[model samples]
Target: MKSIKFNRELCDFCGTCVGVCPHDAIELLESDLRITDKCTLCMNCVYICPVRALEELDEG
Candidate 1:
């Protein structure tokens, strides 16, 4: 399966990823962004993150 990897150190909570996600799979909480099961590995979040904080990961 494909998943997302978050680099908390690089994230700025800019909400770009959350806005770009078509599946509405990304959410921003008080302190962090969360990826839910609805995610389709669409790479929208990965590409939209300004800080490159989100990455696509392959998990077989």
Candidate 2:
């Protein structure tokens, strides 16, 4: 199993993740992103990242 990994370098801050999130877990600022605890690891944001920024990482 894997958890969501945020890559600040790869993120374009396009708000794509914020839009795709069903739980409204992702909040996009002018130059930063805020992910709240409401996230359920649903991967909605991860899958919608056009720049390949968001992804799930393996703990092992």
Candidate 3:
């Protein structure tokens, strides 16, 4: 399965990922976005974030 990972260094704390996640899987973490629930692995948040803060990881 694919999973979402947050690049803390790249995040701008804009909350863009929180609004883009259709599954409500992400939240703000100390001003940055973090995965807070079950993620659909949709990659929407990854693509929508202006800073490219989110990444899709394959669980192997």
Report RMSD (Å) for each prediction in the order shown: 1.0, 1.6, 1.6
Judging by TM-score, tell me the better candidate of 1 and 3: 1
lDDT of 3 by residue, 1-60 (tens): 677777888887888778877888887878666676577677888889898878888888
The candidate that achieves the highest lDDT relative to the unseen native structure: 1
Off by over 4 Å in 2: none
Pick by TM-score: 2 or 3, better one: 2
Ranking by TM-score: 1, 2, 3
lDDT of 2 at 38: 90
What TM-score does model 1 achieve against the real structure? 0.89
Residue 21 displacement (Å), model 1: 0.7
Candidate 3 scores a C-alpha RMSD against the true structure in Å of: 1.6
| Model 1 Cα lDDT, one tens digit per residue, 1-60 | 778899888998888888888889988986788899998888988998999999888889
TM-score of each: 0.89, 0.83, 0.79
Q: What is the lDDT of candidate 2?
A: 0.83
Each candidate's clash count: 0, 0, 0
* Whole-model Cα lDDT of every candidate shown, in order: 0.88, 0.83, 0.80
